[model samples]
Target: MDLMFLRATLLFILGVYANSLAVAKFIATSGRHKVKVICFSKTGERAAPFIRQAAKDYFSEASFAYVLWREIDMAFWWNMFGVDSAPSVVFLKDIYSKPITYSGSFNHLQLVKMMDDYKKNDIPQLRLVSSMELGCDARGYSRSGNETVTWYCLILVGRAGHAMTQMRETLRRASDVLMVGDDSDYARNVNLSVAIVASAAMKENRLTFTWLDGEVQQKYCQFHLAPEYHTKSCGPSYEDGVDAPQILIVRYLRNLTDDNAKNDRWKHFRNQYLGDTKVASQLIARYPGPEDVEELIQWISHIVERGDTREFPYFTFETPDLVPEDKQSMGSPVGQSFSRGINNRLKKLHMYISDLPRDPRVGPSLLLAACLLFGTIWLQNNRTKQANNTPGDLASSTSSRGRARARPARTDDVPPSMTDEEPKDAYQWVTTDSDSE
Candidate 1:
């Protein structure tokens, strides 16, 4: 009977375990981007409605799920998925990797603010192109044979300073135009490749943008450019030979699986323009303004259609030098003193709260604790003193009472002589007056 009951119980537990696994798997696989809100059992019930509602309102694009804090098997999650917090939100973009965790309580406003920037977490930015990964063997070019897609890369090569800073901003401005389509039908077609991929339907960009650090990549940069316009030769002037920023466009051709008869199947295109002048001239017709980025996009589109320029790979156009001026003074004493004051205040605050007695929250409790401690010590001391006096008092009471005296009786007695010693065993007999009769 015992064994039969045990078997039935085991079967029920197994069913429950299997059901839980199924539920967890279903939740994991339900969405491209999953937001799992975790809270304690009591808090979970209260937060559940708000979480669901806010998730819909703020993160309408993502699928949301909820898990009780107790149900989150922290030991398993810590080892398998690296999750170890409650009252937290985890974003699981791809199910294979550990999710990004955002901990603590968040209201609607805070939640929206935190999540707005993260919605585009999957979008690709114009990152730095790696020459080593691409096997370009040269800077200012990305011609990796391993690439599955062709890339028309706009590369800015320069020392990392104020000038490169402007270039980075320009790339961002240009990307805004090139990565999305305007409302017009013609504009949409022009940016069709980018738009199609923006929705995540496509995996690669038809045209990409990136930059290279010239200071570190000087050797490779020199080899890629014409000998006359090398880093050592071209700068502010011919005499100085200082390194200056240059912009170049490289076209990498896709690798063919099977060779077929075609015009230069493996040909790579490059247009290395010297100085900021030629690049800026093509980008900005007159003075550099906000619209220059738009003009630059048009020029890039035209170049993509024009094919490789065989006549002159290198072009130099004379335009005003586009170096940005730094107007602010290097340092300010007032700013330094303000910073120092803030630091000193932080240090003082840290020191003040470093001990239990000093913290404002601990004041009342600490006083109570001190009083209890002294009270206990006083009680113990009194107890010890009383215990020590107890035995002494009892001994004095016994000593105060003299030895009891035996009452004398009238007796016929034999007295021992002074000169004679009494026998050790001899006893004297006394007769009482009452016994005399």
Candidate 2:
């Protein structure tokens, strides 16, 4: 009984853990991506294969799910995403945005095109993971490599708005102009200063163009942007009632002088104090100018020409890490998904166990429950043992009483004098005629 109770308690805990894990998984996937494509099908005849193939191509941009259709849940489909039938696809772009539903057959090319159109925005937002890759992070080296000591990052920082959109378009145009080279018609049409900057950027391959969400990354924006512009550029829009988009150019410089003595001294210092630190000293400069393509290009050109020739104040600080856009790219889709699920479950379990010590109610509550369970099991075992011996005890007592009652009692009234006269017995046998016959 005690062993059974222990097995039952373990099963109950496992059941709860499984239920909590499922809930955690649902929540983890909810905010994984801004876009989610779900295919509803009664038999998964065509949509399943199509969605699976599409997921492989656009795995980094959007998430996909396949749901089996049931007639009983027809109203739920319609009311939620207006998906009233099987063989339909619903694209949920955002939490508050309306869903886009389609119910027709589509070829692979058409599906890919549609996904491309919907999955990404006009300008990719700079995230923690992409910052280093794009050479926008101070601690990381340039995308061109360590040999390229100087690099520039052109960023448009602001909240979402028409102004921000227009600025992003201008930034995109500037990037395109640079990519087009000097002989292009667009380059010739541009001003001389813009052309010079574009030419220098193309020749060096040291410039990267990206955008930042000022509201989301307020600390980074505030740190880089001038104090006067913080009200108009960074933080929530409601605070200043202004969402003016601003462009900032960052220049990064690294020193690669080979001094063995200096290197050895620094190495010794790191070993003694820092202990395996990867932080390096680098100089950074921010552009303080209006948001104009011509001026921006000219500033970049000047920085490229004379940035290394001059000296600037060098500083080091920890920067915020960017969120990765392609977390599922490391392995096969199925393996990645399975590993992610296991990791999430283990992380949740760890968190739950870690919190138990901190929660004041958990310790005592668990102890009380354990004591109650043990007591119940002990009582059950005791009752079962007694019940098994009860019938044997009753049988033994009854047999002893029967034996006692079966014994005959001797009385004092009976005389034993006739036994002593044995001589008369020899002649007494003739008196009994029936006995003699």
Candidate 3:
């Protein structure tokens, strides 16, 4: 009889498990990105409390790891994922190569899921024949390749100082070389592929410079030569008037001071030309930064209003430069101080123009571009930090989250262990009126 009872219990357990699987199927087929599991233990480390709260707060898909053995696992992670201190939760993924994110000393998994919204995760894809723009949403690999090399010259002013080291890394990954210092001969001569740095501390306004004789600097752009006004130059003088492809790069010194000291001619120019425009006068029409639309005019000048050039790819999204830690510098006291640091960031549009390869598989370039597009420097920095830390671990973490939301929930199954028979001696199954009498 006991053997028979055991068999019956096993059958019941199997039935229950089958029902649970069916219910799970229904839920998966029904909701998308709605399923979540709460994995936690009640009497455990701080991990449990956070999971409970996260789940209670409508983190409907939230969960816990229960931290079965804090020390064993902690030790493993410290050696494994570099889990140094408390408040550490990781968001893992099913994919093999991805990022595992940590919220902080007090990091939580729930926070990572919310912050790294599934939709926002993307990598750049190369167009093959065209340019591959990985960095900015507005950027894509675009090269007409049709235009003549209209102009060419080594440009200047590179990152002479910066705020962070990762910033330095980001800069290096962005370019082919770091513009350490002056490339005077390259600047003076033309057609050497190129190497130059911008020394904002001592800008020569070579852009505004007239020939050594007295004629204004001009280019003989195709169909329109004998030009009149100062512009950039590369190969032939206007006398030759040959049109060729032109490349322009703006490098910056690490530290910044008044580029236009006390004289302030730009201010005067703006006051005269833009004074009456609504942009200059009204708060409703605020000013765009110098890199994009002018401080005022372009704002009021246009009939149709929208975003400024800064929002575009070829225009404004530029990051800060890095100053080297050591240097034997030249220039003013301010310039000398910034001499060491050199973090270089190029405008996305220019990168598209430069002959750099396009690989969606790469990280820094697109990551930097994505940061610019989403306009989330902090979040990007965090991603980069997580990236640098526990490289393999982080990637796994993201894959887990992606898979989590994909799994369906089974909300209607009977509890686990429902097949056991009742104990005859220990408990009564029912009450009888006759027995009571």
Candidate 4:
């Protein structure tokens, strides 16, 4: 019985731990919960009642109540949301992603109001499409209208609010993901131009954005909607209240009024549905939910970047599901193409070096020149050494010759005073001296 109880306890703990991990992952990826206020011990206990009251008062349906700091992992928040300080308020659009963080203590009412305002502010009103106006001027750079007519244009046609608002918010957030807060000059200028195809534009060129009213432009709506719904018309007067907005892109040509001009340029002005799963897959490699604005904008940017005016002037946005024959791996072709070009250049360089020694005249001339240079240097060094030794050699030779001549001739070679004479004369001389004395 004891063993069984112990086993059950351990199993229960393991299950709880596994469930917690799964929940954490979901919270990190999906922004389901609205508010996650963290406070520690005494401070959290004191603020709990007020935090609950605030949620109850304003955001009862949407808000998450205060959580004890000990119960929540600080490192997770730090890594995910860049939140390090305690007693912080996290306002989320997508709880699984980065949230708007408020560090330190704050009033409950103010917190509630801030969250409420953030939700309300997400709706995007239609900005007038003109050659004179620019979309998304948050960073500043005005665009003209005439410039967009010649390039691809993404226009959201619908009534303001509801689905339109969600789409617009998604488009805006997509820029944040693609741009990633780049402040460099090139990124700012180039990416801004490409990204604004679905968000903003200048009258200068390339891509642009605009919207149309569903009720006001019924004919235009019906023309785009009929093919998708297989209906004769669309708008408020339609048989069903399926009054959803639609997205379309237009491509225009330049300086040609000939018959082939229509075939070349105007053929790509056809509408492409933004809600298509295949289209979304082209942008982020996964299907984005309706509220996934960031994913949607990235998709638009992908198509705009690949668009070529000379060839097609628009993007096919074809994915594997729609056209399996055209499907390709997710890796970019740019890197592979660049590597192949570099390899070709290196091979040419190797061939050029290998052929250098094959030039008959050049090889012989260089070798002969090198030999002559070495001979000249050797002759010069020999001459310098001989010149330096000339005086010392002469002096040494002169002293040696003088010492030989100064020595006396050998007297040993002279006859020894006729030594052949006998010694009898010496005895006779001694006797004469004695007689004289």
Which is superior by lDDT, 1 or 2?
2
TM-score rank, highest first? 2, 1, 4, 3
TM-score of each: 0.29, 0.51, 0.18, 0.28
Deviating ranges (above 4 Å) for candidate 2: 1-50, 56-60, 63-122, 202-204, 257-291, 321-437
| TM-score between candidate 3 and the true structure | 0.18
Q: Which stretches of candidate 4 lie above 4 Å from their native place? A: 1-150, 175-205, 230-233, 237-240, 256-291, 313-437
Candidate 1 segments exceeding 4 Å error: 1-150, 183-204, 232-243, 254-258, 261-291, 308-437
Candidate 3's C-alpha runs over 4 A off are: 1-50, 53-64, 98-437
Model 1: per-residue Cα lDDT over 1-437, one tens digit each: 99999997787667557646854775555432234433323254555566667756634245565666544255544554455766666665343433566777777766666566554443222212223233221222233232233345566666644555565566655665554446545445454443323222112343555555455445544544566556532232344455455556654442232212133322211111111121111211111224345456655655555433322233333322111111122135455435544653554344334433633556787789999999999999999988787897777766665332344554558676775887888889976897677
Tens-digit per-residue lDDT, 142-257, candidate 4: 23432222344455665533665555555445434344434534345544444454443222434445444455445555544446532322344355545465665544333222
Q: Indicate the worst ten consecutive residues by lDDT in candidate 2.
A: 271-280
For model 3, the run of ten residues with the poorest summed lDDT: 207-216
What lDDT, from 0 to 1, does candidate 4 have? 0.46
TM-score of 4: 0.28
Judged by TM-score, which candidate is best? 2
Instruction: Output the worst ten-in-a-row residue range by lDDT, candidate 4.
Output: 318-327
* Candidate 2 residue lDDT tens string, 389-412: 789788998999999999888767
- Every model: Cα RMSD to truth: 32.4, 24.6, 35.9, 27.8
- The Cα error of candidate 2 at residue 79, in Å, is 22
Q: Output the number of the lDDT-best candidate.
A: 2
